[model samples]
Target: MRTGNTTMRAPGALALAAVGVLVLAGCGAGGNNMTLATGSTGGTYYPLGGEIAQLWSDNIDDVNVSTQATGASVENLRLLDNGENELILAINGVAANAANGESDFADEPLANPDDVTLLGNVYPEVLQIVATEDSGIESVADLKGKRVDMGPPGSGTEVAARQLLESQGWDPESDVEAFNSTFEEATTKLSDGQVDAAVAILAVPAASIEQVATGGTDITMVEIAGEEADQLMEDNPSYSTMEIPEGTYQGQDQPVQTLTNWASLYSTSDLDEEVAHDLVQEMYEGADDIGHDVGDQLDAETATESRGPTDLHPGAERYYEEAGVLD
Candidate 1:
């Protein structure tokens, strides 16, 4: 468990003076407190965020970081824009939409999109389309007129699902029966025959998919390849092609081609450069503590190469340049 300062204030004048001193000291006179917004409980972001946050708090001096469980990507970006979170793990594609006031953020984009800077790319969030073997969903084209879980509202999965449906020239709202639910809920529904297929944007070998496979429901991974995937990637520059190797998940014998968006760390440009520098330094130095498969992907070279929608944070850039990773 994580510990935080919880001293209550006293009422007297002398007490107020003491509190004032404590506040100043706590606000960098002593340390800095920050919150990292991650994804739903069943997804990779929540657990991974906790490990990363703990790693930073343990290794960085005077820095106390906490992780917030969120709806993922879109919501995380909104939280960052509204100042509810100091740091966030978001899909680079969603971040681009938020920056440009497109898609989910069409009504109100980030107040200062330029100020949202990238720390580094954490991992690839592959678009995993899992369908029950009985659903008859052999391909993306077969999703028409079927029951599909499009992921939770305000999640990157939701955005990706809609975009994919659009890429096929179908209206997401009218063409399919869409259910907006968390990955856990969607998996449960899939296992119980409540939904035919579900969409997830997560690391390979996702626990939710694992549960369905082990729960006696034969599942098939729908491929997001060919001309459709190419057009999707061409239209959404933030996305790229990726492959989930054979046997990454239960019952998955062959490699599956799919679209991928990077899961990158983001923070406002106002973060202190020195603090950001130290944070990036410790992220790589203490990477082992992350305790997740994704941690293995963290390195100065890949970190510097996977840029986000906005410019890289100067502090992060400095660390990468000095480490001889940035070109």
Candidate 2:
């Protein structure tokens, strides 16, 4: 939705360039075939989603696969709940919230609990705080009475950022100045000293966060460790202990503590079992340099992290069982 005079490679170009793809077994048209809903074009989900869609198309027969650019995690789940069950890339946190119908989306589960499943932990996303040293903001506790960008309205980052704030006992509405600004706007406001801090939720090795760090703002990250954090994790199983290994950001001397969730691929319950199985099997086997626009954060070890969520689809169950990955 953003038109730019400047082009910064549009995040996931190579995969999108290869977009006009269909499922492997010539799975006919898009009416009932599998579909995937990714995030905004400027974000990592889009291109990574394209590659996953391509993988499904190439592996499964007679099951068409396609990708649609959407408002990221929450919208993806909403679509699935409404019967758009192809596939989606979402923050582990959003997936958990969507699964249980708690917190931000406390109305109800978007889809039936059994209809969704975790494809895998695609990557580890970090909860980050960026600010100038002179801003006098250092930890989560100091965030009250300051301007912060939790994230966009429909994005996964917003959902997690709000939870992190509430866990710290900060009143997002009354105690602090909170705005759901875009990444570009947030960074610009921070650089201009108009905003005291930008609270973000993103995967490790996030290129956008790295760029903000490099923008001469005396960038430093906060360690979000405590019993409160543990409570947050306990309340939402999507998040687990996250660490920013030294040199992860531009100016960190040692590890910084954060919470992260698996960035997973998901599908609706309607997906045919054999087709879903083949799709998962293909993604597991076809890791390559797909060039995600937000940045390439994939690797051999990460792509195969063990222990995904409990809501396993029948098709993916077959893949895991057959690969000897599940017992």
Candidate 3:
């Protein structure tokens, strides 16, 4: 865990400069400039966002798209509300929290939460709980009094982790020893015995988690299922049941039913409808390129799937209308 250095990293200047040029060249007289905010370089969002921006830059003649690496979910939603980024990849829970002024958003609520709307769903972010074999943490209840990394500050993983703890009647203030760090750092702590367990909300088969699994540390993937999982879904509109299939990780012999939510693309209400339409259309048209470059989660059907709790952006609505999907 990085001490006294928890602030989110700023966007790179060189990337911003290149996007400025692209905006100047590609935009029409009105100037359609946009930025897509993703997560840290280590996670799925950064690379996936880069591919999306590339698709938009190449196909949309009237808009210029650039990508920035951010702190994921909560930070991305805040950036979109503040006009720092036009589009963002956010977890459903974080988005819901921001809109409701709950959880991370409780301290500093968005000025106008409704101004943000969903463009499309990219993939499912699974709630993953990894613990060491010696820690004896086989389930959520075993986490009491144990040292746990709740994920990076302001991350959606933290939000999900907290929800799980609260559902189990454990107060984060007194029931557990909590640490805040990036999933990569937390994985190291778990391996070295500095932490007993680590909770992360990420796409399945995470490379960072996989790294620890192969690093000779005996690990266990804790199940977040059964009655508690059902209660969690009932309590949070953003959550849904998901499964981590057998063998997705090393020595995981059974499918773990867990909670999951979509990782979705969102846009501000201010975006020109036509520009938004073009962006969504081009993304779907170039779906195969994205699958080849990133993951297959952005396939046409999944891309256009209903983003629960995420209101469809009118611009995206326009595209879906033309594509004969949004009846």
Clashes of 2: 10
lDDT against the true structure, each candidate? 0.83, 0.66, 0.78
Write down the TM-score of every candidate: 0.90, 0.80, 0.88
- Please state every model's RMSD to the true fold in angstroms: 5.5, 7.1, 7.0
The candidates, ranked best first by lDDT, are 1, 3, 2
Please say which candidate is ahead in lDDT: 1 or 2. Answer: 1
lDDT of 2 at 163: 80
| Candidate 2 residue lDDT tens string, 184-290 | 67777877788888866766666666777788867667667898678777666667787779988788777888887667777766666666666666666655534
Candidate 3 residue-wise lDDT, 21-110, digit = tens: 323223456355567888876677888888777777666554556688778899989888876777899987788788778888898999
Q: Write the per-residue lDDT of candidate 1 for residues 1-327, one digit (tens) a residue.
A: 122223322132234334553221135554666778899998999999888877877766677677777899999988887766778999988988887789888887778787788888888889999999999998999999999999988999999999999988999999999999999999999999999999999987788998999999999999999998988987788888899999988899999999888888989887888778877887776787777878887776777454645889999999888888886
Higher-scoring candidate on TM-score, 1 or 2: 1
Number of residue pairs clashing in candidate 1, backbone atoms closer than 3 angstroms, sequence gap of 3 or more or interchain: 1
| Candidate 1: regions farther than 4 A off | 1-28, 306-309
* Displacement of the residue 56 alpha carbon in candidate 2, Å: 3.9
The TM-score, computed over Cα atoms with residue i paired to residue i, of candidate 2 is 0.80
Q: Could you give the candidate ranking by TM-score, starting with the highest?
A: 1, 3, 2
Q: Using TM-score, give the best candidate's number.
A: 1
Pairs that clash in candidate 3:
none
